[model samples]
Target: MIKILKEVFQLYIDRSDFFLEILLQHMAICGIAIVIASIIGILLGIIISEFKKTTSPVLSLVNFIYTIPSIALLGFFIPISGIGDKTAIIALAIYALLPMVRSTYTGIETIDPAVIESAKGMGSTDYQILYKIKLPLATTVILSGLRNMVVMTIALGGIASFIGAGGLGVAIYRGITTNNAALTVAGSLLIAVLALVVDLIIGTIEKFIKRKWKLN
Candidate 1:
């Protein structure tokens, strides 16, 4: 075990650039997916809240998309987008939509009725209420949803390797093809560490937001 550990350390030392490149690629794919999904999700959430009637239908559609297997989604996109980072980004974005949308909707819907009433009593318009009352009050829940999306995207982002999207997944896939256990373990470990760090950062931010808003 010590020998294996030493070898892994040496591998990192010898090929840090390769690992760094893989990490950056992974971050890029996940970042793009998160941003796209977050924007669409938050907008959809706001729309649903405004309409109320369309919330179920919209959420159901997003939920259906989430249920589709990631690999299958990739396959469906292959013909249209072809294989590469673009396809991966689309898949990851789709996968991320459900949580973000759900969280946004739930957060907004669950806001204190009294708070909204107070805002209205104060002559706040719908837009003012959303921006000042609902959004601020729901910030923590929305952040939670964002964090969940990020973690999920990072976890599944590795599967993109199967479709020629390069990242730590590529390293693990290569290891498996050649029976290189060290490479597989190293890549997997790095991914795990990355996910944990992201989760921690997001959690911290959420806590900060809650405290800042006096939502504690």
Candidate 2:
């Protein structure tokens, strides 16, 4: 194991450029997917929060998509996306929806009804209340969901290599196929570090937002 560790460290030193390129690819795919998922999830969340009757159906739909196996989801998209990062991005975005939507809904619904009533008594319009009050309070919850999605996307980005989406998973998959423990370890470690870094960044932002908005 020590020898394999040394070999992996050497691989990182020798192929730092290629490793960086793969890391960029991973970040790009995950970034795009998470952003798109945030928009869709938050929009649906807001709409469902307003129309309480629709919440169950909408949540159920996202939940169904989330429950699909990653490979199967990617496979289903293969025909249209034709085996590439596009398919991977779509799959990851779909997978990200459930957490975001659920968190947004929970956050909005959990707000004290009396607070909303007080705003209404002050002649606050629905739009004004949403923007000024509800959304501000819900920001932390939404951010929490985003954080989870980002971490999940980073992990899933590795699976995208199976569809030729070209991330660190490529190295790991190749290593597995060729019994190259060093390469596999190198790829896995890079991914772990990347996930940790992203989580920290998002967590920091979450804390800042909560403090600023007094959402705690």
Candidate 3:
């Protein structure tokens, strides 16, 4: 086991460039997808919040998309987008929309009704109430949703490698196909470490926001 571990470490050191490239590609896919999803999610959340009756149905539809298998979804889009980063981004974006949309909607909706009424009573327009009261109050929840979306995007980006999206997943898939257990272990470890680092950063941000906003 020690010898195998040493070999894996050595392989990582020697192929660090390849690993970095994979990491960059993964980040690109995840970052872009999350950004797009967040915009759409927040907008939909805002719109749905305007109509209390439609919030549940709209969120339910988004949640349903989350249940579809990533691979199957990718396959469904392959013909339209072809196999590459585009399809990967689209799939991950769709998957990410659920948490963000739900969190945003729930966060806004769950705000104190009294507070909203107070804002209105103070001569605040509908736009002012939304921007100043509802959104500010919901900031923590929105951030939490973004955090979840980031984590999910990273995980799914890995699977996107199977379809030629090129990332840590490529390293992993190649390792498996070539029967290089060392490579597979190394690649998987790289992905795990990357995800851990990202989550840690996001967690720190979430904590800061929660405290700053006194959400706790």
Which lDDT values do the candidates have, in the order given?
0.89, 0.91, 0.86
Q: What is the Cα root-mean-square deviation between model 1 and the actual structure?
A: 1.5
Which residue pairs in candidate 1 have backbone atoms (N, alpha carbon, C) closer than 3 angstroms, thus clashing? none
lDDT of 2 by residue, 129-161 (tens): 999999988888988988888898899888889
- Model 1: residues >4 Å from true position, as ranges? 1-3
Instruction: Choose the strongest candidate by lDDT.
Output: 2
The 10 consecutive residues of candidate 1 with the worst lDDT sum are: 207-216
Q: Against the true structure, what is every candidate's RMSD?
A: 1.5, 1.4, 1.8
TM-score of each: 0.95, 0.96, 0.94
Q: Give the TM-score of candidate 3.
A: 0.94
Report the C-alpha lDDT of model 3 over 1-216, residue by residue, as the tens digit.
787679889987898898888989888888899899999999999989988888879888987888899999988899999999999999888888988888888899899899988888899999999997899889888988888778777877888988889788888898899998888887777777877888889889878877887754
Write model 1 residue lDDT over 28-124, tens digit each, in one string: 9999999999999998988898898999899899989998998899889999999999999998998899998899999999987998898899999
Candidate number with greatest TM-score? 2
| Pairs that clash in candidate 2 | none
